[model samples]
Target: MIIRREHAGDRPEILAVVKAAFPEPVEAKLLRELFASREYIPELSLVAESDRGEILGHVITTRGWIGAEKSLGLGPIAVQPEYQNQGVGSALMNATIEQANKMGESTLVLLGSTDYYPRFGFVPADSMGITSPDPSWGSHFMALPLAAHKPGLHGQFKYSEPFNAL
Candidate 1:
């Protein structure tokens, strides 16, 4: 398996995987909105592929705010039904995360399963004094400060307009 930046041509396959991974329309709709929005940075989007060139999973990073501070947000990481639990999600995540670090991002935020995210270094957003616009999420919203010595961000996150479209 391999992980790499997704090209424009890969959108269809990426969406297919999202549909298979999550049957709900919400995640798929979010994917489309993010792709069409100005906040979408192609370089930060990634996919997992097999050695045979089959697209197996995807992950997207988009512009989001922590209070007034700007940072990246990871979401909608999906693997095809047949590929679930095969580390495809992890591969895509590690790749995009490494890229964000290389690009000097201050942090990465996510809203994910509380049980799954900690393996990737995510701590409860509330613990970091970070809050999301939706209070119902409680501890499910999370953040990981990427840069050492970087002052922590503490404020309500403003997700990109595309997120609102969902």
Candidate 2:
């Protein structure tokens, strides 16, 4: 398998992978909306491909904010159904995190499975004094301080418009 930056031509395949990974069209639609939005970080949208050139997974991180400080929002990570549980999602995540840290990003937030994201060092957003706009998420809304934790990093987290639309 190969992990690499997604290209313009990968859109269709990425959409298909996302749709296959989830049971509904919501995530797939969100992916398309995000791509057209200013929040979309082209370099941060990554894809995992098989040796045979099939896209097997996708992940994206977009502009977000923790109070007035700029942060990243990670989400909609998806793996092809056939590739699920084979490390495709993990590889995409590891690569995305490494790239984000290299870009000097200070933090990342997401709404996801606590059981899954904790392995990547994500903790409850509230633990960092960050609150999701959606109150019902509770512990499922998580945050990870990519760099050293800062005093000003706490507050309401704002995701991109595409996420807000959901």
Largest lDDT belongs to which candidate?
A: 2
Local distance difference test, candidate 2: 0.90
When superposed on Cα atoms, how far off is each prediction in RMSD? 1.2, 1.0
- Clash number for candidate 2: 0
Pairs clashing within candidate 2: none
Displacement of residue 104 (Cα, Å) in model 1 is: 0.5
lDDT of 2 at 95: 94
Where does candidate 1 have its weakest 10-residue lDDT segment? Answer: 145-154
TM per candidate comes to 0.95, 0.97
**lDDT (tens digit, per residue) of candidate 2 on 1-166:** 9999998899999998888889989999999999999999988999998999999999999999877888899988999887799888889888988988889888889999988999989999998899999999999999888864575767899998899889
Model 2 segments beyond 4 Å from truth?
Answer: none
User: Candidate 1: where is the Cα deviation over 4 Å?
Assistant: none
